[model samples]
Target: MIGALLIILFSTKDVWAPDNINGLILLYNGDIETGSIVRVEEYNLLAYAIQTTLTQTVLEI
Candidate 1:
């Protein structure tokens, strides 16, 4: 959905700085205090977010 599209659009290497695009994906969906922080590349973050989104959509069906 929108989140996936945003991830793909922002993931373009030539258009965006990887350092500036760094972010955290809440592993538990909420309750951030319990989640662990792991360093990852920008592309990896985008891929992981897209994958998680798609998986959730599929599971919802």
Candidate 2:
């Protein structure tokens, strides 16, 4: 199925920070509260946003 294929491409990393956490803390935060960020090599600054459980449900089109 397409679902299984998508999981294969994710960059799996164990994250631990105050702003948020994932993988291990999947329950209380609603099934899954995953996040990803990018850093522009020219600026050397990072930015990210949480793909919250609610937003995902509405945008699953």
Candidate 3:
């Protein structure tokens, strides 16, 4: 019974791992980025996501 329980626990964790594909940059939380998500680097302890936006200024000079 113990062996079966262990297997079930491990399998459940693996299923959760692949589901969450998004990650946040801890230091730069306020900064907005533009472009599509290219990749994610788990080995480097980093999460990468991209977004797209136009560069413009609201204030008239």
Candidate 4:
């Protein structure tokens, strides 16, 4: 999960430079089925929260 997220993030930032992290996430979630769905959703929400918090923190700094 974290690996996928890192891939996605790096891909977004043009850092690690994957062609399609979104596709990878879809394949991963599909392969794992219900558990993956739940976990991905939860992780996404957590990631969003963390990102928001970090952004806010950086702004305050």
Candidate 5:
């Protein structure tokens, strides 16, 4: 059950250059990732994060 959730989570689409507000994402594994959440669509949520090291991470909400 957990594995399936992970697969679904990682499989969701990523948002880029979003025009929205910042929010926090609480994962099922007790990990938290923050980013600007554009919005939630159909079965997926979209967000993007830029790190201090000049790296970017895009994830589903």
Candidate 6:
């Protein structure tokens, strides 16, 4: 019973990994992006792209 529970617990990590949606970003150019928001500055917003594994900054929006 304990071993089965452990297996189930570990498997859930993989299943929930992709479901992590930090937030949404709406750009002024009419493009939408979903990722983990890094920072919000005066003139720009920075976020870590989930699909690309990189940081993106939007100056207009």
Q: RMSD (Cα, Å) of candidate 3? A: 13.2
Q: Where does model 2 exceed 4 Å of error?
A: 1-34, 50-61
Q: After superposition, how far is residue 4 of candidate 1 from its true place, in Å?
A: 0.2
lDDT of 5 by residue, 4-27 (tens): 987776675354212111222223
- lDDT per residue, candidate 2, 9-56, as tens digits? 453322223224432354365554344454557877665535544213
lDDT of every model, 2 decimals: 0.37, 0.43, 0.41, 0.39, 0.43, 0.49
Query: What's the lDDT of the predicted structure labeled candidate 4?
Result: 0.39
TM-score of each: 0.22, 0.22, 0.24, 0.23, 0.25, 0.24
Which candidate do you rate higher for lDDT, 3 or 4?
3
- Local accuracy of candidate 6 as per-residue lDDT tens digits, 1-61: 9999999988896665443432122343324455545556874766564443223333332
What TM-score would candidate 2 get against the native? 0.22
Error of 4 at 22 (Å): 26
Which portions of model 6 show Cα errors greater than 4 Å? Answer: 17-61
TM-score of 1: 0.22
- Worst-scoring 10-residue span by lDDT in model 3: 52-61
Top-lDDT structure, candidate number: 6
Which clashing pairs does model 3 show? Answer: 34-51, 35-50, 35-51, 35-52
Q: Assess candidate 1 and give its lDDT.
A: 0.37
What C-alpha RMSD separates each model from the true structure?
14.4, 11.4, 13.2, 14.3, 14.1, 9.0
Candidate number achieving the greatest TM-score relative to the actual structure: 5
Which model, 5 or 6, shows the larger lDDT? 6
lDDT tens readout by residue for model 3, 1-61: 9999988878897665443322233214534354323333554333333442232212211
